[model samples]
Target: MEDRRRLLKALAACAMPGVAGTALATPASAQPWPVKPIRMVVPFPAGSSPDLIARLLTEKLAAALGQAVVVENRPGAGGNIGTGMVARAAPDGYTLLLTINGPLVTAPTLSRHLGYDPVRQLAPVSLVATSPNVLVVDARLPVHDVREFVALARSRPGVLNYGSVGNGSAAHLAMEQLKAAAGIDLQHIPYPGFAQITTAMVGGQVQAGFMVPVIAMPLVTAGKLRIIAVTTSGRTSLLPAVPTVAESGYPGFEAISWQAVLAPAGTPAPVIDRLYRELVAIIGSEDVRAKMRAQYFVPAGTAPQSLRQTMASEKVRWDKVIRAAGVQPE
Candidate 1:
């Protein structure tokens, strides 16, 4: 018995170094988080605003993190498909979603059966950028400003039609908000995407619509479209001469589109912190700011908590607008 006890004690003592070595080395080995390439899912088509922003940041992020950041376009179902992909992705910081306000804030209220809950399944990393929508009309239209447009609409109710990217899109909601505030009747024409909406507007299929500054400015400059008013409370630098919808007649009319970065829920806090820091740095940098400004996107790198608050507040805000607009889920 004595010999057996001594032998057992000796074996136990011999195993201590190996056990301790593993316990100490495990965390060290895991310290470098991005051991592999990271995939950023842009829940919009390539060349879309959100995708452009993602591609803009990919190289910087890759350089900073020492890993290849791949931007994948997965556009479908008003951005729900790609968003759901990221929501269901593993919470290891390997996958992320860079999207606009439509999917994160408005879609839940618009769709009855979303596969993933953004608030519950995704973690906010940063609010990347924001840009106001420009209300533009076909150059052939007689109206030149918001009031003129309203007058024309009132005179020819339902005769003047507006096109939007989709039913629940920001463009659609902005028009609905305008209709409610201005008490004008205009027909709503829903298109599959922005390209189609631009085509319809140019072809005179629709006389007017709200569009992003990047798309509207070129058309306006080319005499294909005319900018009547911007959606934000203040005029954009891109269209400094154009008045705002609020200034045109309505006082509190403001509908700004924004983009943000998010990860699957349960992502490590440290990883989230690192990403937030890097993103804020990148967004706030002069070069990135210049690029964003060239695209008419206002650089905004809000903290995660602020973004969360914005999400909650926007939900309440859009809910009222959508309900007031009488937009029902499809």
Candidate 2:
């Protein structure tokens, strides 16, 4: 309500004699926002899930905002380098970030030199989508489910290794939390991205991992990997046959993979509110929802407060797991 009022006041100021002229004389900066291309930064590799989703928004957002929404991939340091770039960018609403929870939640707890504080440096736009991670292992592994896998890892202890895209990634933290809950010891191997992790698992270099269904399904379909259980609190509809880690034995386990859009902190509340509304509408559209579901994501066009709440809860949840896992900051 306050933001709407402020926006209205700004517009009404234009009606005042000489205010419009003064705004014009002040330069383009004084003009209406989004007069030029807006950059949407994806702190992950091109063609990754976040990348694809960012592209999905670009087309519609360009039309909706009457500006080119260009996507720039700035992948490195577990999504920190690019994330930090957006965090430090001028809060003029021209730059934005479409990233996952690594930098937002887990990395803060796990990385010592992380340059950005997500809570203080970024403002929420909306929760784009959420997907449960699936625990999968190479087909040749003797484990059939989470129980057997736990037993196998327990039997081997530190000998069994798991792969993740990078330290503090959702897959990394999910497996770490599982290791804590299941009382098993597994080595952590960081890969470049989802594809590399899958390749390593298929080659038998790493025994298992927790990854989104989009990346795990094809390997499972080709009989190169076997599904164990999901990280969600309950069984997901996309893979109903697989039980959740919580149901398997641990009663309250839940590690969801989610993505969100954010801008530098101190961005105008009016701009933030406008972004939140537009993004929610874009994600809620039938075509967007259908494609999101096809990629195994549950569309979540939630409000800014909802996104902030989820981030806080996830930080608390992952903080305990990261500490328990004894993953030292790098």
Q: Which candidate number would show the highest TM-score if scored against the true structure? A: 1
Candidate 2, residue 173: the lDDT equals 82
Total clashes for model 2: 0
Per-prediction CA RMSD (Å): 2.8, 7.0
lDDT of 2 by residue, 1-330 (tens): 999999998877776768684776677546677789999999988877888789888898888899999999998877888999999999999999999999899888878889889999999999998889999999999989888999999899899989987899998888888887788999999876787788788888998998889888888999999998998877889788898899889888888889999999999999899989889889989998898889888998888889999999989988888888777788
Q: Candidate 1's C-alpha lDDT?
A: 0.88
lDDT of 1 by residue, 30-140 (tens): 667889999999977777788889999989999999999999998777788899999999999999999878888888988888889999999999999999999999999
Note the residue pairs that clash in candidate 1: none
- Tell me the TM-score of each prediction against the true structure: 0.91, 0.89
By TM-score, how accurate is candidate 1?
A: 0.91
Off by over 4 Å in 1: 1-25
What's the residue-level lDDT of 159 in candidate 2? 95
